[model samples]
Target chain A: MCQLLGMNANTPTDVMFSFTGLATRADEHKDGFGIGFFEDRGVRLFVDHHSARQSPVAQLVKTYPIRSDNVIAHIRKATQGRVALENTHPFQRELWGRYWVFAHNGNLVDFHPRLHAAFRPVGDTDSERAFCWLMQELAKAHAGVPAIAELTRTLAELMPTLHRHGTFNMLLSNGQALWAHASTHLHWVVRQHPFGAVALRDEDLSVDFAHHTTPKDRVAVIATEPLTQHEAWTAFTCGELKVFVDGQPLG
Target chain B: MCQLLGMNANTPTDVMFSFTGLATRADEHKDGFGIGFFEDRGVRLFVDHHSARQSPVAQLVKTYPIRSDNVIAHIRKATQGRVALENTHPFQRELWGRYWVFAHNGNLVDFHPRLHAAFRPVGDTDSERAFCWLMQELAKAHAGVPAIAELTRTLAELMPTLHRHGTFNMLLSNGQALWAHASTHLHWVVRQHPFGAVALRDEDLSVDFAHHTTPKDRVAVIATEPLTQHEAWTAFTCGELKVFVDGQPLG
Candidate 1:
């Protein structure tokens, strides 16, 4: 199985350290590696089909420093398709006058759903097909950007239908709020005031957030596994969905 | 806010298509993107600090194809860390002779847990700290490989302790099974025989997995959100955990 990681915050922040460990699993050390993040106005992405452990680019990524408010990252292990650039994770698109990002962790049985005019797939994997369909549905539901509550409610209703076919765990964002759903397994955690020091699982490193940010800053993290051995990481039920904004769950 | 995606299968599968859509939101579109997967022997990874929508590498990922049985993917909006390589998600490590992959989507407040071991952080993100703590705990719990049930129970006991500090939702895998937990929000779904069509949420695409897999194949997906418009995606309850192996949840 593959791995996933994500972050949401009340203030703009960086995810360099967490990403450093994640990149190692990509083909660089074992498989390829990829990352996506939002900046001042747009999104940035980097991917290498080569193993992250072996790739110079992956190494560079570990040393390079960048920051943002929302972020997503992935590492690859070929299963359904050959290792190639076209099959990387953390896909992107334009929707509702803003950029939308999506990533998935599951296999579909025979997911050949028809598409409307709003969304389309650029790859051959089942994950991409599902992304396109979601965009299509969102477009059909509203002509323009909808309220967070409305959008989330719609997604809650649509999620189960997709889960019926196969595994359909995914992450989605529009630079405003993050939406997460699990058909089988997923986990999350949020960090806020009273900043503290933390260490990494993959490397012998740690940092104190209190030294970096104000007490007002709030942050949320979601992943396939708990990053820390000491901290509590909540697990998602078999069928649950939630939306997050500014490091807090939407009402 | 950031996004996450994942897939688990009874047989080998690929997540290229799903990743394609997810990568788009990293920088120009979202912020950053990363993906992780488990191969036959180890974990593989791919990540980029660019947006999946505009990064040349992101385009290549969509065109290049890679497959895997277990996969995880993410897209970023940079709520926690900088836009550099070190901050990407889907971090990895080696445990028990197998590659263990982890990714996070929430933040911790004042989470300065002191490490008893040498685990450290490579970046300035809180996610890395959590990853390290988890590894430390695992190392302390089992000197060598332990039974799945034992490991699961140990994790269950550890979870509440970690949750006390803040929200903790995450995913973890050691190329054997995928474990997920939810604190605020996460979702999942299982797919088995009698596969069907699935659509995408970010793009226009679809696939028929029934045409591609054997009847014995079973798969499970976990994510921060649902990726399809026409399928059923289950949501995880607050503070729940589940494990998926060979496309089915372990009891």
Candidate 2:
């Protein structure tokens, strides 16, 4: 199985600590690694085909300092395609003058859907296929970018149909909001105001969030697993979907 | 927030489908990605610090064909440290002539523990500190490798103590079995003889495990959230720990 981690916040925050713990599991997921972040103007993306465990670049990621407001990460265990660069995840596309980022965590069997738009998959991953399909659906739903509520409703309608094929856990963002859905497994946690200390479950490290975050800062973390062992991470019910904006859940 | 996905099976089953979808989220987590797998002979590892969203290599992971019995994957969103390769996860250390893989999802506050063994952290991340600490603990517990049960008990004791510091949810494996502990948030699902179709909540995709898995195969998926929208995923209670082998909980 692969893994995913996402963050939506009211303030620009760094995920260096949380990411350090998650990346340690890449030894067996040699397929690849990728991460995307939204900064002031656009999205910053980094990816490598080498195993995070073995890749020097991956080490740089842990030691290098990078900050952002919204972020998503994925580690691969390669079930559908080959271990190549073109097949990486967090597929991105330009839509409505905003860069949209997407990542998936399941397989689609016989998921060859007709894409009605110009958006094409650079990789052969089923994840990319689904991403393209989402773009197509969004395009067909409204002539232009619709309101968040409308977009959510459209996603709710389109998600079940996609589930008919296989596992479809995914994370999506347009730099303004983050949309997450769980077909099988996904989890999330929100941190705000009175921040506290957090420790890594995989590693014996800890951090005092209070030291870095502010009282007005609100942050939401979504992932295949809780990054910390002590926090009250919430689990999304099967078939549940949610959208986050400025670190708060959007209805 | 970062993500982790793990699979334990009764037999040597593949986790390709689940991983394919999970890898898609790497864009927001472009910090890095990593995966670990345990086979009959030894453990296999792969990882990269690239964003799965755009990394050609991550795309290959989704499309690349690989199978394993036990698997763990991670996508990173840098929080505690820099985005470097050595900091990438699913950190591996040799113990008792077997390779052990550890992946963490949380951050530890002021987790600077002293080490008295050869095990040392190559990265500045606290996750590595925990890994080294675990190794050191194991080395101190018994001169030679003890039984799995004994090791598990030691871990249980060690885990709760760590949780006192902060969130410590994590997955640890030594090739023979998987030990999972959840101090705050975590979930698990078991798929067996009666396989069914699963849809991803994050993406418009699905897969019928019945088609790919045999009746004898029993798979236990552990994650921060349920990856499929249709499957029943059980949530791990606060301070709950379990040992999984052959896709079932151990006594």
Candidate 3:
């Protein structure tokens, strides 16, 4: 299976520590890797068909401290589409004057929806097609940019159709809120206030979050599995959809 | 004034040498810098609100050698919009299932069009507005991606409306061909057989094209001004629009 990593923070925070953990897992998922960083209304997306284990782009992401409020990343194993740069996640598109970033883990058997609207997939991936359909449906469901709660509700209503096809584990962000949907394996954890030292499960590297973060800093990380061994990671129930804002899951 | 650099090659080629020259000019045009590389149907866009001279992303771009068939780069001076990532060029949008990249050099005065279509400007800049308007009109003009000649003619018809507003020197590409329109200053050069050593105008960098290029390899480089010291760069006349495919301009 491919690997997915997402971060949502109350303040602009760097994901260097978490990304390093994810990159170590790129040995098996060597098809491609992509990461998107949201700086307010703007987004910076870096993708490579090369593996995160060796891609220079991934090296930059590991070293550069690009502080962002929301981030989505994926290391692909190429379940369906060919291993091309266009087919790498997370895919990006502009809708309602906001750039949306999406990354998917699980595959769909035959999830081809009619894309008659403005949103179209440049890549030949079931993931991108599903994303375009979601964008098209979202555009049709609302005339303008709707409120976050309304958008979340609309997404909740729209998730079942996609989940019915197959494993629909996905992470989506519009620089406002991050919405995560899982049909299979997915986990999340939040770190706040009394941040402690954390060690990566895949690598010997560890980070003292207490030294890097303030007492008020809050961060939520979602991944295919728990990246850190000691963290209180919570697994998502099958067919559950959750929205995260300000580093916490919304009720 | 901002600086613009575009390259369309018969084969996938790297622009590190030419981009180094452009980065040298970023001393004056230091609001931000962005470069978009078209690798087949995929695009790698790197934008930084910091100057290219100091940005780690730009440094990685300089050293990584990402080869592309079509490239559009801009180093901004921020005449209209604030120094923000959303306002950085070249702006990108998807139409007809192809990714189109655009970067503008000159500014416009009072050029606002009704953006009722799917295309919308995320940044508050006349250039982006003009680009959005162009995409809107192009979508309305053709049901799908048109032939290069037909698209060029439509652009020729569309140039005057934008040029009348103010200077409108711009470059656009959709991974197939590169289209450049000029109202003030724009130049292009084609380098092919018998490739010789060339020196950058601003930087001390020099490269011998004969070592890296084959006899049949052809490349066309477009910029606001000539990037090299010894090259036959042709200047575009007022209201002139040219389309380049496979490293040579089409009449």
Which one is best on TM-score? 3
Q: Indicate the worst ten consecutive residues by lDDT in candidate 1 chain B.
A: B20-29
lDDT of 3 at B93: 91
DockQ of each: 0.01, 0.01, 0.79
Flag regions of model 3 displaced more than 4 Å. Answer: none
Which candidate wins on DockQ? 3
**Candidate 3, B110-219: lDDT as tens digits:** 89899999988888999999999999999999999989999999999999999999999999999999999988889999999999999999888899999999999999
> For each candidate, what TM-score against the reference?
0.51, 0.51, 0.99
Worst 10-residue lDDT window for candidate 3 chain A reads A77-86
Instruction: State which candidate, 1 or 3, has the greater lDDT.
Output: 3
Question: What lDDT score goes with residue B240 in model 3?
Answer: 92
- For residues B1-251, could you state the per-residue lDDT of candidate 2 as single tens digits? 77888888878776767776677555578788877777643455565667767654455446644456678888787777788655777776655435578988888888887875546675678887888888778877766567878888988878866777677778888767888988766788899988988888678888888898788889899987778887889998888889998898888
Indicate the DockQ of the complex predicted as candidate 1: 0.01
TM-score of 2: 0.51
Return the lDDT, model 2, position A11. 87
